[model samples]
Target: MSVSVDSPFVHKVWNDSELSKMVDGGVQFPMLSDQGGKIGTLYGIYDEEGGVETRGRFIIDPDGIVQGFEVLTPPVGRNVDESVRQVKAFQLVRESEGSEATPSGWQPGKKTLKPGPDLVGNVWKEWSVKDNYDK
Candidate 1:
């Protein structure tokens, strides 16, 4: 779910346009419009003076709590891929019974850290660098 200060009609127009062509199948998520900036204000992303919001992405859990959020400046575009990865990580941790933690640059099927006193000061020892993470 994506929320913005634009009207729902404006969202429809933008969704139909070529603005999001880079993403395969374009924008498929529900785009909620915060026409009065109420949601943006609630999320602390609305700029009252500018009458616009800095790009904001929030991942809320099933319990209505914010699990993660990212706010970018006007000039910088939000990383949808990173947001997706965070959502997956959050879900994985939630289902791990407090036993697993996703490491930096983690993705699905990647190695996860098992948090414990043994891993407290020897994370580097437990997690090895075997692959090109950038690839």
Candidate 2:
């Protein structure tokens, strides 16, 4: 699952408790935190003065390479199901190329393209999708 760095998304005690209940009701996820804006800063997610991360989502591989990154203002919400879909796509691509990354909202069994300095627009155009991701 993917979450914003802003409201209704956190890895705090309250969130953990709620997640635990969700888990008891059958939900599973590995939680992560941008706590104190440390990781946020490293990823350029800091609001600096407000000391709170605005809104950002990053899909990273095991090697800590960022496959995708998204930053948003609070007014806009993040796309969740699409994010999961992308993870599955990344998993597939990674397995296929032996270590490759996929673009946003990607899904399994689709065409996987390589990314590089010259392949930006192509990457976005290739993976750009329209869907109601909120459940």
Score every model by TM-score.
Answer: 0.85, 0.55
List, residue by residue over 18-133, the lDDT tens digit for candidate 1.
64776677787898988878988988999888888788888899899999888888998987788888999999999997689998878888889899878888988756555317
Q: Whole-model Cα lDDT per candidate?
A: 0.84, 0.65
Candidate topping lDDT: 1
Clashing pairs in 2: none
lDDT of 1 at 32: 90
User: Measured by TM-score, how close is model 1 to the native structure?
Assistant: 0.85
CA displacement after TM-score superposition, residue 92 of candidate 1 (Å): 1.0
Task: Write down the lDDT that model 1 would get.
Answer: 0.84
Best-fitting candidate, scored by TM-score: 1
Give the range of the ten consecutive residues with the poorest summed lDDT in model 1.
125-134
Runs off by more than 4 Å, candidate 2: 1-13, 16-35, 98-106, 110-135
